[model samples]
Target: MNPIDTDPPPPTACFTYGSLMCEDIMAAVCGAHAAYRPATLQGHRRHAVVGVAYPGMVPNADHRVQGVLYLELPDSAWPRLDAFEGEEYERRIVTVETDGGAHAQAWTYVFRPRFAHRLAPADWDFDHFLRVGKARFMADYVGFDTLQPR
Candidate 1:
């Protein structure tokens, strides 16, 4: 008889500043996702990644990036998200400021050191992403390969 295994607990939150800020995109990446709240990560700046539609975050002492804080993420979603993020981004802990004056600790992806060369100097714009880049991303960004068995 095979022994049964229990799944890991779901993630309570993650702060997203890139394409994942889009609910539709999140659903596609993580299948039936989580709740999100308006959030701003202080001391970081969002920059456009050259040749790609999404953005990457880098530390900046005086800058802040606005995004969303996702809540109740499913455990199954992390593998897919981690895969989609690839080695270019590293998951890290950070505190975010919200409209209601609340500060919350959440996980977010940041650009890896070697990949920093790919980040554009100008800050990435979220509203502009929805308007100009999202369509192309949903249609063409490379995803799913990481989920494949080795």
Candidate 2:
């Protein structure tokens, strides 16, 4: 399915597979009350790489990618995530399946073609990422003070 759709009316949920999976990262962008559920998407693969805290998604030759489904956040959070990821990533719509078999629509970041070839394994050590990377990303995110910066 081609998941990309125009912004949904206020109160929309997004699926995050990278740094956003970290609670601190979510809090930095979506606020402390933001909620999320474990979900998985098909036909994509998550890779691990060195030098990055989050995993990278590659077009799966034979598998699906697993990720978390975040609860809808205020429209204000969009720019936060956008700035956190920068221009190399494009927000795309994707359908994620919950363990209970319900389907939900959400946004996910995908690498642009220009960087696709350059993306290596994400080196995604979940334990390390959750414990370390999450905090670091949030510190950097919140440290900025403003998305546009002065």
Please state the error at residue 44 of candidate 1 in Å: 0.4
Q: Across residues 81-109, which tens digit of lDDT does each residue of candidate 1 receive?
A: 78888899898878888767899777789
Q: Residue by residue across 97-136, what tens digits does model 2's lDDT show? A: 9778899888887776676655675535567777787666
Specify the highest-lDDT model's number: 1
lDDT of each: 0.82, 0.69
Q: For model 1, how many clashes?
A: 0
Instruction: Per model, state how many residue pairs clash.
Output: 0, 7
Work out the TM-score per prediction.
Answer: 0.85, 0.76
After superposition, candidate 2 runs with Cα above 4 Å error: 1-11, 131-146
Candidate 1 lands at a TM-score of 0.85
User: By TM-score, how accurate is candidate 2?
Assistant: 0.76
